[model samples]
Target: MLVYSFQGFSQERPLQQSKELPQRTDAPTNSQQPNNPNQDNNEKGRKTLEPRPISEYKIISVKNDTTHVDTALTIVKDYEFNYLRKDDLHLLPFTNVGQTYVTLSHTFNTTSLMPLFGARARHFNYYEVEDINYYHVPTPVTELYFRTVFEQGQNLEAFFTTNISPQVNIFIGYKGLRSLGKYQHILTSTGNFQVGFSVDTKNDRYHVKTHFTAQDLLNQENGGLSPQGVINYLGDDEEFDDRSALDVNFEDAENILDGRRFYLNQSYDIIKKNDSIQNNQITLGHVIDFTDKEYRYEQSSANEIFGEAFETTNLRDEVEFQEVNNQLSLTFSNAVLGRIGGLIGHADYNYGYQRVLIQESGTIPNRLIGDVFYTGATYNNTIGKLAIDGLAKINVSGDFDGNHIQGAISYPLSIGSISASVSTNSRRPNYNFLLYQSDYVEYNWFNDFDNVQTQRLAFDFKSKKYVDASLTFTTINNYTYFAANGIEVDQEGFENPVTFNIAKPTQYDEQVNYLKLKASKTFEYGVLGSSSDLIYQNVSSDDEVLNVPDIVVRSSLYYKDHWFDKALYLQTGFTAKYFTSYNGDGYDPILAEFYTQNQQEIEGFPIVDFFFNAKIKTARIYFKVENIPSLLFGNDNFVAPAQPFRDDVIRFGLQWNYFL
Candidate 1:
């Protein structure tokens, strides 16, 4: 609801690694569980943990440290479901308009620290990823969420967590999503399961955290509507009244990605500890992790998508990735450090392997061995907190091409806070990029590419009451972009052609520079609320390569009130967003990438959604009507070059949580 400023952060930072647990006052002794099978009774009231301070809330996201606690002054993000789309395709909260691009953003990013086989487009990053969240509670807790919008799309989630003992906690969660997208022959199915446990000794000297994650993602690729068919819906051609009547490019194309991860972290205190809030103690920890991932693309009737011509047979490409890592760390802290304090040093060893299987080529395997060293320090007081981290990596037997250094610092001001970060990464191209072979014309490639180096600097400022802003500038050298320029002779300008061999950009002299600025503000009235966001972007290259809208604006107005004797609360709002016109990327299903396209410019259209959310006791429900204007009149709001945005949809969702 509001951005945070360090200057206005008044509360004292809670001591790090606090060893405190709330007592279960209501539950009778475990000795009574055998005699009282009346758990079905909400009957005899029991005691539960009192609402803890916001600073005690902890969420283990991939962005931050898993053990770090959350606080009120920490930044808060709007609900990701605001756009009526959750966890699907190149989208993030606060700013995203369903642009179809291979990369999540045309900006700088932190590459995955793990070994990757690079097959992301097919899954939309949802089914192939895992996010871990932790909540501390005295009694068993469970939350169920289900949502359905249109067609056969269904999003369902189940999470349960409980404390086995005062010092031990366990949790298991499942998330399944299946969306038969609005367009033809583009269906997605994903299944994700995770289980984890956290334990601590009675004296809090020894602790361990472990988890197992599995992800299975499947998608039916349609390769976007064919060129001829794409132009039919551009203007008022009256192609069809209903969206389902549209045509598709690929019918038998399918891509499947399977992944499994095992992780464990254990630590023991070697030095003594002080009873004070700040402490002098020594902690040594060990980390072990392993990951196995596989990506496969299958097309039975290649002729349907890409003609049987060009000596192309039924297409099937499979690749597997495996990685193992071991790490050890030592951390020490003292009271003299300030409100927040800590220092840690760590070393890591990693081994990776890859296997690729193309048309009748059998299995081709490759291996790599590497090591990395890291050191980090943090200091915080009532005035402000600062953290710094440095890392260096080298491959013992392979190459030290994947090496980088990153750092960030933040300070709070009187009315707002500001932070800056920088990262430089120089690494060898991914295995898939280096060597690829297939029977299809455009799907086969073998090239030696230069190393990729990308540097970025970012600065952000946030105000507690009014507005927040951030700016990012990225410069990429020797960028390896999946180009759409070159292809087979038969595939050039062919109407409804099935196969496309996009030329890959391997070497470049000029640096690709991209700059982005984002600002948001919220206005409050007596019973009405309004929030607005503005984004501006520019790129050094022509509009052909990185198609970015010059400006994007999103605004929302809402009213909140309680009725039925304050037992029912309601929030009704309408959100509208607009993006300036620009040429964007076009997706190629065969190669699983988005190549540059200078075809049609999609912009000037406004997307609006009417929503109503109500809270009754512990349960919350929301209803939304998305893209009502587009469904009523006016066309040409294509999310990608030829693919249109989702048609009008009536969506509703519910969240019910229980603690027993």
Candidate 2:
């Protein structure tokens, strides 16, 4: 498990290709990108970051290869299985979410405006997958583990305004929210997005305005897992494994699992105004928003154990869900007639919902599902001039929703510039899989297909100082896959009538493509600074998302400045990655027979990592030493621990601020 990465860090261009800075058009533009290395502002409103003082300073961002770039196409560990996996195994599972925003302003005498208060808190944590130890067969036990999740929310806002004479101003606000503490929200309420006003305008215009929003979150605690107790706890581990002559293929094998959650929301708005076009100013709006959801499921399993060595069944049953939405709008603007030009427009309406709760534990399991609520309409536009700008958007929802469109264009031509864009994207399906009900009961299969889609086409380019490029293509439809196995039979006349078990179902229709390149260069010779990246990936898994390695490549490098007089500031970096197989299609025969029961594909090696960053000023100190040339993985199934190959941290801090 030491798959590839000798050295070739070059891949960093992709923000929708915005035209790698030469000149090409698809129309839609505005330019302003760069600045924000650490956020700094001078003059009198002074602000700074990294020089310390943001509340005792302490911000550590770590992803250690972002879960191996989402599992570099299937397992590649062996520093003795990363020291024998287990510790919330996550070869790739994201979202350790975090959000913080606080604003307070009061200045009725400085500019004729005051009264604005804000508080926003968002927290997210998802850590599921407990007890999964598979040393590739042969009595390697470790099961019965599930129940690990957590989600949180809190929000409050207050508002006021003045300066009705400058163009026209008005404000009003009220928002309160709370969602207790739990892992996997089922329901939790608190809502608002209200704004009210009356207006009369200038600059050859007429206006009228109104707005509304309402949201709900109650009973949020849908922490799933009870499908017949996960199919009788994996059918008691296949009734105590130990089959004779080996020949297992119960449709890929998966005992039992479950999940469900619900939520609802509301909204409304109306507007009228006329300023016929020029730089651009037109408004005609009528919009509304609404949403609802509810889901549930139950399952069971059993069929062979001890006798022919383990056998069980239960896939899923118990489902319910709902959803709805509507909107209509038309807007055109000149960005308050700014330093040149800018314009925009919008229109909208859509609704959808579903319900399914096929249960059978304490009753209710007769299969009664429901669906019907697919509506559509949407449009957007933008225009700008000076540096340059152009943009457009279109959306059509219903019949599983999704009919997107995009356009962009930008040209700075001086202070070193370039931009480009092209788009057609759509990704939907996840209201908990259109209302859940999944099961496999250890080897007794069943399935219920839902509308699934992933359509994309993208191109981007940029050049402000250096260069950047990106390309993407995707196609996916009605994709749903599942596999499991476990079979055993026994009967010796008398009372033994018949009892054998196994399951099956593997869904598909997928295609993926990607190409990226990024570059950053700034060097006066010494104290140097350089950045580079290049990546390419391709995948076609009609076999269904598994060990997807279609192809991959990654790169990285960095150098820093200062040593003495400047007190001390140093930085260093190095990284490399590459993966291949798909079409040349390899691996994923049920995770290669659950790890080498056959079906090969795991021959790619070369791993490397190195890091160093130090600073001493305001007592700032940080030391890092990761995979300094170890490229681990020694087997034992792999899950982490090749001498911590990475994740070495040493930091100390100090910061002070003064303002009264």
Candidate 3:
């Protein structure tokens, strides 16, 4: 582990000042003295001061971990220069910006006690409570990020924060993107806006924090490519080089997801004591959260690709979800007991369509509305050289029953730290699995499903001198997913028949056992360095329901040095990634979800990119040529079924910070 050092500041006068000079007896009184022209004095006769060290600017996480602003250029910073502003090692991006990503990995660790809203693809950029951060800085700070997109637009994020007083801080931020893809009818536009503030009392006994967010993600869906389009894409003909020239399944369909949220968290210390006097304290905390979201799909005319629909023109389907949650907690802390806390929470939710669907065989209700009460406990302690943490939660009264328990222990060694954890969770499936309604004839259904249970054990080791590695084994029972029901038919085209599958919700009856191991290491010699990341996964089940590639690997070779007499830091690298061929999942435009499919075996191919990054002062610049291999080979790589990967292109971006 790497520990950062922070510079400290003090307000005390210099000791040499008292011994060097003394005030004369005839000198004017303090108020009668003339002020310096360069000095800025407050109403209280104090000079305005600005922080000189970056450590004075703090960023606080939900768990209260504090880290300062960093302005260094490193390999980790280069990997996170994408639209998502995070490392994309375990994810596959779509051809267009602001689009969904294909998941290449899975982790079963969770603390949520309620079923999630469906349309997970749209939630990739959604900001939840845990995603938000609080800031405490001595002066105002601003950050700006900009990047180029595929064809016509750009992506940008702007953030600003300032401290009004020693106890109050506020911030506002917005991220927006607009991109017209190389293909027809695949444009994407998204926006996210957030504003928040944090305040504490003069005595530091009480604190309050609150935030509000509004977000919208919209995509013009063309249902991938038509059968002929796929043929033309793979043929690599010069005439069809322009993707817009190719045909598509439909051109008049689109989907939109919009949401708004308000959150508040406050804490008060009732009994406080200094650690030197008596290491004992008691605190009370409360949290309130509210969210409202809607997902809508619209088409000007119905298309036969999705089967029959009720209306031929002006077809639309929409669903809404709203939730409100409140929690109260009490905690006790001591030198011997560490920290222990208990909490009780209540959640009220409403999810469904606007009207019921009355069919010949059955009737589907309009909505599912209910209230749930839950209780949970948390503990953290350190004994000798080992640290232990545990949490347990269960629903006491609710329409659905769910429980979660997790525990972990970690110990530090001479070079690094090693940790082991175990967790078990039992919860209902997502809202869409239990109930859904759509205009398409094959898309409406309601069912009663059993709770899904999952148990996992994991071990991890972290060391910069050695290697970072982790292994996890998980078992899942009553797994639920979306799959397709295919129907083969002969068309008028001059070739073999084709198959079209309609997506539907389903649950697997047997248990699935899965194991994953990932390791990464870096070696540096002089100015030349090499880094590699590898992942191995295996699945055991009676049926071919769960599928993943057996091997995934990424390697990078780079050169780093300071140029212009150490004023500019530069790094140039080549990165290559590959995975074994497997049966990849298929995407559905109507449901905005990926379903299990075994018909098409997607072949694995290597993708290589060249990047040049540099840091000058408080700015970081990035330049990359993405998918350089595609320029020399055939266009056969696909992120999903019939969805070709992006072509070779040059992209550039930059991040800059300002302090005042």
lDDT of 1 by residue, 378-439 (tens): 33333335544334443333433455666667777788888888888776666567656544
Candidate maximizing lDDT: 3
Order of candidates by lDDT, top first? 3, 1, 2
Candidate 3, residues 469-500: lDDT per residue as tens digits?
Answer: 99999999999998878756465573776777
Clashes found in each candidate (C-alpha, N, C closer than 3 A): 6, 98, 0
Candidate 3 residue 261 C-alpha distance from true site, Å: 0.9
Q: Residue 537: error of model 1 in Å?
A: 1.1
Model 3: lDDT to the true structure: 0.85
Query: Can you tell me which runs of candidate 1 are displaced by over 4 Å?
Result: 1-78, 82-107, 111-115, 127-130, 235-239, 275-279, 304-313, 336-397, 486-505, 542-544
Could you give me the TM-score of model 3 versus the true structure? Answer: 0.92
C-alpha lDDT values of all predictions: 0.59, 0.28, 0.85
Specify the highest-TM-score model's number.
3
